[model samples]
Target: MPREVKKRGRRQEHKERKAKTTDHHQRSTKRLKTDHTADNGNALEVSGDAGDDFIGFDIAQPEGAHELQEETQFHGLLEPQEQEYYANVNNKIVANDFESAEDRATFIEAVHRETEGKELKVASSQSCSRYLEKIIMLSTPEQLRRLFSKFLGNLSYLVQHRFGSHCCEMLFLQAAKHVEKEHNKNASTNDDLASMENLFLQAAEELEPNMGFLLTERFASHIVRVLFLILSGESLDDDIVKAMLASKKKEKLDAPASKESELPENRRAVPKSFRTSLDRLIRSGVSTLDTTYLRALATHPTGNPVLQLLIQLELSASGKIKLSDENSVFHKLLPDPELEEDSESAKFIAGLIYDPTGSHLVETLVKQMPGKQFKKLYKNVLKSRLRSMSKNDTASYVAIRILERLGKDDLAEAKELIVPGLPILVSRRRTGLIKVLIERCAIRGVDLQDVADVIRSEYTKDDIDFLSALLDFKRNGVQDKTQKKGSESEKSAKSAHKTDVHGSLLAQAILQTSDICNLVQDSLLAVDVSTLTAMCQDSASSRVVQTALSPTEFNIQFRRHFVPRFYDQIATLAQDLTGSYVSDALWSATDGLHFMKQRLARDLANNESQLRDSPFGRNVWKNWAMDIYSRRPGEWQALAKGQERDQPQGGPQQNAPTGEKQKSAIELARERHAQKKSHSTNRKRNPATGANAAISTNA
Candidate 1:
């Protein structure tokens, strides 16, 4: 009973201890539950008493990270923002949301918002463009017409802006379409053109101080083209010019009118008819294109249309500026550049000559610029820059056109300009420029004596050289005549072979130009056949001889003199390799090809079989020209058709062949055969046989 009572006492104490331990735990659990419920699990569910302890475990990350990134890029454009913008646009388009002006305004605003940064967002642009295309296409004519004026105002900015360029192009096309639509209903183009012209005029006025920048702007260039198109009409101010000058905007829009200039300040003033279409509309005003406006577009990409438009305007014929006019004010337009300093006018033309786009402007200026303007361009700029300009392929074309238009006096002046650079142009093989210049001079009847004299002086007796030292000639417009002569020795002739090579190239080019061939021929005509024969035998000089004597060259009356005179030398020349080519040049001469054919045939008649067997004679007949001769083996004619028959006709039968001539031809052939046999026999004789060798030597 005592042990049981002790155990009971211990149990009672344990139970009291357990109750004490549970009391705090139950209170903490209840507090956490209460806290979690009140806060709605926004914070950690763990009680503050539990602190920040956590367990660690392995995490299984997502697979295909590379593929996920690649797949995320839309349309492969590589821009996420652009992709999103395009996607939004497509969604908006699908919903027919562009039907209302509000929708257009909203879309435009979105586009504007997206394009806020400096760099053009290509994606946003595409989206905006697509939206504009849809709106322009879906909108009614009334809607387009209403929006057209506002669009025109923003056109200058839109054309140059990257995102806006596409929209601007769409708008331009649509606006033109609307204009055409209005055209069918008794609508005057002037009304539509007036508004557009007014906008451009206003833009031009506002952008005047910054004309250079406006001209260069990618978008603003479109506005320039538009202005030019409006200017392409008959009268620019027929409708708007009445209010010009009085209303500044309208005046700027309308071109100045055609008027005669009486004052020095107004000498450069072109009549309204010669200016833009707007100019024709003005009744009494005048305007001129200044250096400032020209400077801006001289190098721009869209400069082609502007230049073409400028070139198309007529030059004022009745009252044009004369270069020789004592009181001319045109030169004053530019700051007078000193002799050492490049004139401003000169600088401008020179700049145009080198620019890729502006070079064409030089070409047009040559064709259309007045004599006074052209003279200034040539004397001040082009004359000094010929050497550099001649070498450039683009500039050379301009030089060609310029040469074609100049008078004899101007051409002679041009010759002096080229004299200093002639050798370099020759050495560098500027064939195109040389040919063009020579051709122009010949066709235009300019004296070739100056150039011919220069060439002759270079080909001295001792050495035919036009080296760098020789290239530097004084600009007196007269060639030196008293250079000491050297012996025409073999050494000198050999040295001249170098010049002969280039000379031949020059000659060939000269000969190909029909108009100039005669000039060159006349210049060198005094050279005798002995000199020509020596040249004709040479490897290089033969080309020159051939080209000069070619029948195909125009006005080649020289052929009649060449072929008939060289008739006896034909057989000898045809056998020489170089001479054979000279002989063949006759076959191709265009002037008197038939005369040459008859000449060759007549020579062939005299030496029938003998000539046929000759090496040089073999090349005279071309395979294509063979039909002109008979193929009969034994029916050799007395002479070629149209040629004088050397032998008299037989007594009773004029048409019959002469037996004596035939037998003589046969005997001559036999004699040649026997001679060939004897020669072969002599060569084959054994040298070891002394008696036979002595006999052969004696034979």
Candidate 2:
């Protein structure tokens, strides 16, 4: 389409659409007015009841809520001055990332005045809720304490209020240090200590009665976490403990009956929206838990993270706490036949081995626990179960790290643990884990036929090549930042020259198992040529193509064999926008890194005629020609003589097509000199011939 004609069509269409939209709006307004006139009498009849109730509820104001009937719209109606005040407070709270003391005070004073039972609910608009979370994070201790006073006086009332419940959660999280320090203060007398520890015990005791109400509360469930933190470790106060028990029951009851009915004993439960928040609550305050409470959380999706944190705490802090007592969570990991494989105690240890949330705990024991504890945990697992768990995504990540950690300590046991699981890891394409087992188990002299079988069956040749490229850079320590392949790693290099970051990073952290690099190189060399060629053309796998084709120490022999056999493809790769990267790597290998430079130089020198005719080949030739002419002038003269012998026009075309633009100033000057010499020779010959003819005529 002509540019101006196309633009005019678009402009005409836009005007027609705008006219239609305006007409639609006018029609809608007229319809609304017609409907309102018809309902005016009914609205007048209901206006009497609207003074105290709007839409059947009090204090139910929405940001811009309104009605055709005004009778029921007055529930949250405020004086003009009051509306202006809250609006200004909301703006100030939302404006500053780090609010000043003055802004905080203004927010607190405004909330304090209207902090009565249901008054704060009016401020729970979508915009208000969004900014309120930010203010909760920035609140000062003094402001929080005063704010807490407004709601804590009536805890149940606060629980029922929409926005008040959220405000209370912030007060509790920020007041944690204040309470903890108060509990440890230097008090000469009990009275001084109790006063310092006032809020901790007072809040806990006052809120204890309504624990179930708070736990099941849509916005108030987090309050239960705060009360639990105030009770320091090992001090299992029965009432507060009972409150926690009640909260768990509340979590169960809060679950919808339909979902509860849908799940069977063996099936996973439907996830709750609030589950992660409650899990984080448990994780943050897990230090205050006893073994009994820790056990309660072991099998829970969210609660399991709490037990994991407790295990980490126990291992890292031996002086401060005891964890192997009869009442302790880990006490069960010590083998006993009566504990049985399917028993709660055995299942608890098994959960850590395979559960996504629980695997890190298993990894901790493998990597950092005492030797005796490591043996106890490993022996407890059934080999079949270990195989089953290795196939899981999250579990496999930690499982590999565990294998390596154990391999370093006792190679024999690590092999036994890894060999059985290799098939599952390979079938699942858990390449990361398969690599660790390959490296760590190889040194232990364990046979890897089963693991190798899995890799062969599952991964394609390109995948194998990618793995080899990662292996090369990993061994070489030359990394590119574009490791990951998705949106999260968008900061990756855009240049075709750069390598993948995750592939490089994953390979970089590989154990110093040099034999594994050789094994991967052999596998790559053995990959089908057709498969390798297609892989080289792919953007995702091209980095691997570059590294594999380069003359690295690990792949030097293979590169020599591969490059000459497919010289045509190698030359084609030189000029391709994407494939050009591989050619660049070859140049770097021959000149820069000097990896078998003589072999590469000899190969190129023999292909001189081939390089002259191809575009990308000529690019490679120019680079080598510059180097030879600068430092090896004698060799340069011989190379020039050989290349210029059969030039198309009996002169060097310099790789340019036939055109006026193809001739340089030097070539043009040579042409002019040749023309002048020809003219002078012709003039001399003609004059001599004419003089001879005249002499003959006179005779």
Candidate 3:
């Protein structure tokens, strides 16, 4: 019978092997068809090696199949060991499963065997029993009190040495899952739920350190979801949630290394693990200790989205989440107090402010923090944040936005804050902010003219000198007479007698005439020409007009009275004014000759003829002639002689009267001749007759 059974077994094995080979061939055929379908529509067209036709059969069998089948046939041989292993695992998972010490020992031994000396660090059966007993026997208050204290201690330790905390976390997580299952089975009170939560928290404290290993978003998300469930007393595991929170807190406190470094050595860097963990914990809805969390987050080597979200949450909780409040958060995030003299935080902050979404927040912060302290802080932060921004134009744009917000209301404070760093900004061609700052300075009574000088000295190549001059002209009066005179002297010395090549003087003269009108029309015109040019080119005409018209009261008074009278005087001597030498000389000579000639011509023949011509005509003519002769007696003789010389060249007039008349005429003529001779001698002797004689000299 034994021989027959052995032969039968061999035949059955052969048959099974044949069946297996057939099954492999069928699978191979199906695979071929699938591949053929993928490639084209045809099948059974074999390619490559036919020798490998049986390779599929080798892959189909399970490894050690024969040995496993033999072991299964002798299952009773290891049933006790299997049962013991099962019982041990069950006891760790379920407190009431193990009834005695011997049972527990047997289960542990089986677990040891099954695990092959691998660490079988399972919860003790006794500990499980004790935990169940406490849950059943203790009041809710007692359980919570014990759980809280235990959790705090465990959490502290976990935070200190997080890498070794994973094993503890896993054990606690299992316990939490078990508790959750139990709670679901029996509906419990809120207080009982709280007690259960405390227990989970205690486990979480032990598990916190392991959280640092979670790198994936999904893992962090899972942890966070679990935490939220715990907080709300939902079906999710609490221990896992607590572990995530504790881990996140530890992460926030950890110092991170800067991203820019050359050396690569094994040293602790700010673990990305911590950030992921925190993100997960937050998503889980874990309650944070606000002040502490914020402080810790603020100290991060780099910014974190999670921390930013946390701040938003806290601010929102405090009812500070308006548009303005949102802006404040952005500003706060900006690097301030200059952590590094030149840091990237400033640039990052600048970029944030530049974002369309963030502009409102920036505006809000400026508005809310309108105090000197805030201004100083903000200025420092802004400077540092923009320090490393290669796109200074963008930075400048952000700064402009900040200034615009600040200038609209708190201009003085804004000016004070920005003026000190104007040089640095100007060097970068950050005109947007510079312009806003300049406007603010004007509003704040700052003399921006000097600002140009300051910036020029500091940022030599920057084209801000013109702006400075503009500001200066606006604040102080445009013209300093003393300075102008000095400048004129210097200019004159430089040019000597050379005519102005550019007609600049003529242009200035024309401009001067119209400049007053322009000034009266627009006060801004009172500024330097360069400023006016800038305004004309870059600013709106309406704005210039508005600025000009701002001093309406003063302009009205000046135009009405002072201007007209001043112009009338100018008109009176338009041709014979100080600028004309010929007119001046002619005017002086005419007046002097009148005085000298009137005195000598007082008794001439024409004077008598005018007295004898007619009573009225003679009297009138005699008075005019006598009046002229009275002023200049010497000029009358010279005039009479000139007339005699010009008369026809004849011997004498034969219409002579008596000796007395002729003697009188002769006496008059001789007297005229004697006076003329003397006057002629005086003229010849007078050095003033020479071309070299100074016109100013009186001979």
Q: Count the backbone clashes (under 3 Å) in each candidate.
A: 14, 5, 26
lDDT of candidate 3 at residue 398, scale 0 to 100: 50
What CA root-mean-square deviation does each model show from the true structure?
29.8, 24.5, 42.0
* Highest TM-score scorer: 2
Q: Please give the RMSD of candidate 1 to the true structure.
A: 29.8
Model 3 lDDT per residue over 1-699, tens place = 455445456888999899999887776545355664667664443222233311111112222222111111210122455446545554463554557656654554444345332221211122222222222121123333333343343342322222323323332333343344334445334443443444555434333333322211212323322332333332232342234333454322111112321122322122233334433444232222222232333323211222333443334333333223423333235424343325554444444555543433443344444355345535566544433331344445555555554534455544545567666654544445554555555444545555444544653244433323222222121222213334756444323322221222212221223222332233332335433332222222213322332223334433333222212221111121121121111111222233322332332233455334434433333323333344554543444333333222111222123352333436666777999999988874534556557664643
| Model 1 CA deviation exceeding 4 Å by range | 1-158, 161-214, 226-230, 233-367, 376-402, 449-509, 512-699
Arranged by lDDT with the best first, the candidates are 1, 2, 3
Candidate 2 residues 338-415, lDDT tens each?
Answer: 445566656666766656556655565556556555555555653435555557776776566556655444545555
**Distance from true location, Cα of 149 in model 1, Å:** 10
User: Please, what are the lDDT tens digits per residue for candidate 1 over residues 246-294?
Assistant: 1233112111111321112212222232233333321111122344543
Give the Å error, residue 243, model 1: 36
RMSD of 2: 24.5
By lDDT, is 1 or 3 better? 1
lDDT winner among the candidates? 1
TM-score on alpha carbons, each prediction = 0.35, 0.42, 0.22
Model 3 misplaced stretches (Cα beyond 4 Å): 1-360, 368-380, 383-391, 401-431, 452-539, 553-699
